[model samples]
Target: MNALVQKSTASLDALKRIHPLMPWFASFVLLLPLPLLALNDYQIYLLNVICIMIILATGLNIVKGFCGQVTVGHVALYAIGAYTSGVLSVKFGVPFWFCLPAAIAVTMLAGALVGIPSFRLEGAYLALATLGFAQSVEIYIRVTNYLGSASGLGGIAPPSIGNFVFYDYFRYYYLVMPFMLIAVYASFAILRSATGRAFMAVREDALSAAATGVNVRRYKLIAFMLSAVYAGLAGSLFAHMVPGYVHPNNFTVIEMVTLLLMVVLGGIGNIWGGIIGAILVTIIADLTRDFYFYQLLMFGLVIVGTVLFMPKGIGGIIDRYFVSKRFVAAREKTAEQKRAEAAAAKSGES
Candidate 1:
């Protein structure tokens, strides 16, 4: 038993040695200006959509991926952030920068409020409750004339700070990229902290976690709130990127489903998976958008296929094939050595 423990400890130490390099690798890749240098207008537009979707996936992963809670109404909070920023900046004469944080705070509160009820329910019941809440929020937005009702809000201008103007995709790219980086970093930090462990414990077995003095409800609410804040921040980015107007339809059911699919397909609990899954799904969806009628069908097929073949998501498949194989090989070698030692002992006894 002691030998087994020491072997496990040695393996974990090796894993830890690579941990410090992840952030460095992530930063290096993010610094690439390929989008600014090579992409044309159409391609830049596609990249913008994919970047925003990646942000959305990271946010949703906080709730669904890390906390093991399923939330289908994420787009509603996203819409809230977009409209809140849009209305405040466009109609109320607030700066885009100022409205951004306000929207996040309000949406975070709203998420906590919703969690109070939904978190009390488990499994399908929780999902249904969230779905209902999202619909209600959407209906409220549709009926409110302050949001321009059915016609939607428009004429949002590009943001500027001290003579620097954001007038095109290149400028917007820098703007959105920072927010994406911050969100990803924040999610990574959360997953590494005690709160993250609490969430994992709650996810693995709420009753077991509760037995160990983990405040299951509080942590769950925290996860929900954090997730909402992320969605709200994403919404703020979307509003600013478009730099004009938001409509009720802007936050659609399809967007929510897409975010969930990205989270699930990327590998729940795996941060990189969420980022990659978002990009992959967005790229594929955009590729098919030219088809108009067939786009939805294509998206459905991709989701179904991924689930069937890679049910653990793409990240799971990679871990299983690459990481697991190494561990298996190491174990086999250890077993063979033990058998050789037993044979040597028998020969010595003879």
Candidate 2:
């Protein structure tokens, strides 16, 4: 066992030394040809959906995973972003470039509003509060004539550069991919910084974190706001994607549940886990679309099974495997040193 672990450790170390960024580089390279290799536009469209979900899942992970906040209204914020951008472009004739940043700013303010409840509530109370917020947003949109009420908002323009418009899945994929990569990279960078450590400390024990001079409320708000920025970006992208429409029904409780599932299935707090979860959930949803009657049942079973048998999610399993290997390698090294000392003593005595 020790030998096997030592070999595994050595292999991993060697791989890392060879190229620390190799995995990321390889993934980028592989995905570059996806548009060309795709059999049709549907596949490209699915890929675009996956990219947007990646941003959503990553943002949710920052708050729920890193900062330990329970917020179900994330999708509501997402809807706000979509509508904000859609309205700006449709009503005011704002360019897509300007609408994107404006949507993020608006969503950040909304996110801060959502975080206000976290200061006074927690657990089920917090969840209920956010759920209420989400419902309220949906009702507001549904009843407001300016937002198109039940008919929804339409006529949003696609992003463009001069004469070039991202009107098709192929062009839009290029647009979304860069933003997704940057979001993922930025999340990873933030989680590795001092602020990230404070967020994790609070998650582990808020009282202890407070005692250590961490402002629990501030970090929590920051988490929510940062996550809102991600949702806003994703919303803007979705709003501009093919069809260029935004509807109240698209951002309801059902959508919130789906976001939660992505986080849970991916392993809460695991960055890669959220990405994996998004991709898997999207693909599974597509495959099970034919059996719409049993879709919710199947998703429920999957979540239950994951929680019962692999609570850490897939990322947790990977982490545990590597941890065990390192432990075994350390033990083997210690044993080897003791054996060497013993042999030296025996030789000296002889």
Candidate 3:
């Protein structure tokens, strides 16, 4: 098992050495045919949903997993992004291109506001603060007529490149695929960067990080804003897809819980785990659509089970295996060196 992991890791490293982005390039090429390979359009739609969920999960992982911020308001940011894009396209005659960035900008500002409470609050208090923001957003959208409150906002313009329009699920998949890959790629890049290290430091021990000259509040706010970017991008993508629409019901607490399920199931701080969790959970959600009544229970059970049995998540197992392999190899080397010295002493005496 260790040999297999080592060999795979080495191969990936070699691929990186060949070209840093070779793996991503390969992944992109592999994913390009996914829509064609799907059984039907609905499957393609599921694939798109999976991509959106990946962005959402990855964003949550950044704040909750990396920065250790307990936030339940991420869906609200997503709601803001979708609604912002919807309003812009429907009311302002704006293009999807403009709406996309506009949504992100709006959500980014809202994210900063949501993060303010984090400056003084921690744990449950911080969560409550964000939750309040989330509830407010949802309720406001639900009641406001101009925002298409109960009826939902429609007529959202799909993205186009002059003649080509992403009007179908198959075509739309291409639109989201690149962004999803970019989000995942950027996430890994951030994890390897200094800012990511600071976030983790704060996650591990905020006091210690601050003592080491890390600006806890600034990083905390940055983390929230960054997470919001992903959420906003995902929301915009969803809003601009075919049959473009935005609804408040879609951004409720239930959605947040399911999003949380993805992060927790994937393993909080593990990037690949987030991707894996998104794929698995989205597929499962589709398969169990008929059992909607029990969905939350299942999610709850899975989370509790994962936490109890696999706290670090599925990726953690891989991390531990490598650590153990290195430890065992080091011990064997030390033992062999001691045996060599013992043999030399015996020969000299003899």
Candidate 4:
């Protein structure tokens, strides 16, 4: 274990020496061949979904994990982004590039509105507020015929450059990959910045954070807005993908619950954990489709077990391993120092 950790540390150091962004570059290079390695088109599609989920889950981690704000309305922002993009592409004849930015802008406004309630509420109260927003968005989409209502909007145009179009799964993978990497990199950057520290301060204790000169309300709003950018991006990508269809059913309570599970299972507030959780959950959910009702039951059991026995989730375990390694090293150092003192005393007496 020590050897592995040392090797990883050395690799990270080497990467840092090369460039601050070398790790991200390496990650992108590693993922570049994934679609080619897939055995089938379906697997390639799954890769796209995983990338989208990573963006969404990482956004959620920013708010819930970093800022300690509980919100269920993230799906509503996601829905808004999807519908915004779909409407622009279908109803207005806008290209995907324009639609994408429009979707993110709208979601950012909605995110601010969602964050308004956080000033006065926390925990379940805040969750309920967000839940209400989520349900409202879902219901609005279901009843509004222009938005396609229950039937859903379709015939959205694929992204293109000149005559080249991202109409196939293979082409679409490239479209999504760079965005996913940027989102992940942005999250890590935020986590290491002054804004991220302010967010953690607010999460740890808002009152104390205020006392320490942190503007709790402002940071909370920033967290929500930043996270909303990711949701909007993911939703827009989904909206303009192959066959281009989005239903209100996709943003239901169950979907929100599943998103939450990604954060929880990955380790809340952990960037890599959120990414890992998104990948695992996407694959697990896909594989369990054959289990029917047993699938949901299994998910429930896993959630319960995770909360009860693994509250910190997989990421936490990874953290503990490194911590334990450091502790062992410190212990050995102390022992060696004590032995040196004893040897010195014995030599002096001789």
Top candidate (TM-score) = 4
Instruction: State every prediction's TM-score relative to the real structure.
Output: 0.86, 0.91, 0.93, 0.96
- Candidate 2: stretches off by over 4 Å: 1-26, 342-350
Candidate 2 Cα deviation (angstroms), residue 259:
1.0
* Structure candidate 4, residue pairs in collision: none
lDDT of 3 at 105: 94
Best by lDDT: 4
lDDT string, candidate 3, 205-255, tens digits: 999999999999999999999999999999999898879988888998778
Minimum summed lDDT over a 10-residue window in model 4 is located at 292-301
- Which segments of model 4 are wrong by more than 4 Å? 340-350
Q: What's the C-alpha lDDT at position 181 in model 1?
A: 78
Per-residue error (Å), model 3, residue 12 = 1.2
In the range 1-350, model 4's lDDT, one tens digit per residue, is 76887998889889989999998898889889889999999998999999999999999999999999999788999999999999999999999999999999999988999998899999999999899999999999999999999999999999998999999889999999999999999998999999999999999999999999999999999999999999999999999999899999989977887888888899988888889999999999999888867866777777888889999988899888889888999999999999999999999999
Residue range 1-350, candidate 2, lDDT tens digits: 76786686677677668797654555577678888988999999999999999999999999999999988889999999999999999999999999999999999999999998898888889998998999999999999999999999999999999999999999999999889988998899889999899999989999999999999999999999999999999999999998899999889866787788898898989998999999999998888889988877777888898889889897787678779877887999999999999999999999
Q: How far is candidate 2 from the true structure (C-alpha RMSD, Å)?
A: 3.0
Error of 3 at 73 (Å): 1.2
What TM-score does model 2 achieve against the real structure?
Answer: 0.91
With a 3 Å backbone cut-off (N, CA, C), the pairs that clash in candidate 1 are none
